[model samples]
Target: MDFSDLNEALASESYDQIGEICDNLMLQAASEGVPFQDEWPYAVHLLGHIYVNDINSARFLWKKIPSGLKSSQPEISAAWKICQKLWTKDYGGVHESLREFDWSSQSQGIIIAFSERYRKRMFELLVSAYSTISIRDATVFLGMNEDDAINYAAVGGWTVEPNSGMLTVKKAAVAVEQKVDPGKLQRLTEYVFHLEH
Candidate 1:
């Protein structure tokens, strides 16, 4: 991976671009039979997962990380804790860490990658908390201003009652059945999702 470009992308918050770069690197690494001798690549892969809020993929990557590297790299350990906290619903702790993590600590990219993940969590909480909610209340819950809240409702295709700042969350679609994972060990991990795509 090109540290210069990667760092610039992190600073720019170009998450999709970061995902593309990291995914390509991973494909190349795999093609060359690269082993997990260090934490840098895994950290980049984890950052990509954070970019898209794919905790399942993140756990898969974390699982594949060799134990030596996981404990050896402070950044790797720290990033895994962020994932673990999110997985376990420790939002307050994750938020606190995110707030303090910065470039000066030498992990700004890892820090910022989770902003999207946290926002996604907020959206999920809003939807799951109630079948419907007032736009004003949603704004408070989502930390959005009124106009932005309205725009958000519109963008989500939510039903907004005329002249009432209320947004209704329709029953979201879900899989008819959950797939089973063949790997017993991975299936047993609490942080890992067992269902296949």
Candidate 2:
């Protein structure tokens, strides 16, 4: 796999394209049949998790990692720890550990790709936990400025009151299952799939 393409994709901010490159690199590395001495595969896969917000997939990958490298590889180990914390909803631990450790080499492809997403996730967790929180508290937790925090909240579909600088999250409504009309369903099933606009 060419590292140059990864760098170009990062420079162009083509994140989805980067996932393809990461997957190809990982597959190529694994097919070589050598002991995994490099942290590249783990870094790419974990970042794939961060980009897509699929903790379950990340957990599965972590569990499948070779036992010898689980403790020996620093970056991979850290990524696993982060995934574990994410699985447990331990945002505080995730934040602290990310602060203490550096995943610099993975920056061009993965680390930079997921930085903002991670902050937004922390913001989401905070909003879900509290009925209402000040923009100040949110800024500190998410490591963003007041204006950015408010903007983030707004983009996240949260209610931010300008008067008091507080963001409020409305409790989500429960989903109700509705039964489909049997006649309509039968008619639809009789035909080939139709694309809905």
Candidate 3:
């Protein structure tokens, strides 16, 4: 139950150990009557924002939020500021170009090229930023060990499975029957329990 111990466990990078640690942590939090369900929505929102390259805007808005107002009021003003900045910096010329140029006519003339490599790199950056907290402190906050926290993150589409030698939750889910497969549950349970011992 020690936060310091949990932090140490997470730093080890062993997925199984992490999962076990998170499972116990979650159980402990529940025993203390902490309401994790309430936090789930925010977590999902964070995931989506990260997936879509919105982390920078989110961070900018976070910084603009007044210390007192931030906690007491909604962050709509901060979000507005971020939107204004993004529009001015990135999309400012787009409207004018579209108006003056034959952008619409030319758009379909050739493939507007984009790099899969670049997109993947951007996704990695977003995932790295998202993992900074969720893969560590947020997991601790949620009372999960490293592995369970990582698993939950994967389930939420934050991380990709290894190219080989790992049974990803998605793969396991697809291989099973019923709403929640008992076999997969057992596998996860055994995995966590083994790490604890």
Best by lDDT: 2
- In terms of TM-score, how similar is model 2 to the real structure? 0.56
Kindly report which residue pairs in candidate 3 clash with one another: 18-146, 18-147, 19-147, 19-148, 21-145, 22-144, 22-145, 25-143, 26-143
lDDT of each: 0.66, 0.68, 0.39
What are the per-model numbers of colliding residue pairs?
1, 0, 9
lDDT of 2 by residue, 115-146 (tens): 66688667767756887898887876776678
In candidate 3, stretches whose alpha carbon ends up further than 4 angstroms from where it belongs are 36-197
Candidate 3 lDDT tens digits, 1-197:
34454445434422223324444555676799875542322222222232234656445434534455544533333233323433454332222222233222212111111112223343344444443343444333333455865665565465534443232222212355559789999999999999999
Best by TM-score: 2
Residue lDDT tens for model 1, 1-197 = 34566667767777656656666666666788875345355666576676566778788878877888887765666667777776877655565545554433335655555565565567788777778888877775555577887677667667887676678876567769867776865657744554442
TM-score, candidate number 1: 0.52
TM-score for all models, in order of appearance? 0.52, 0.56, 0.19
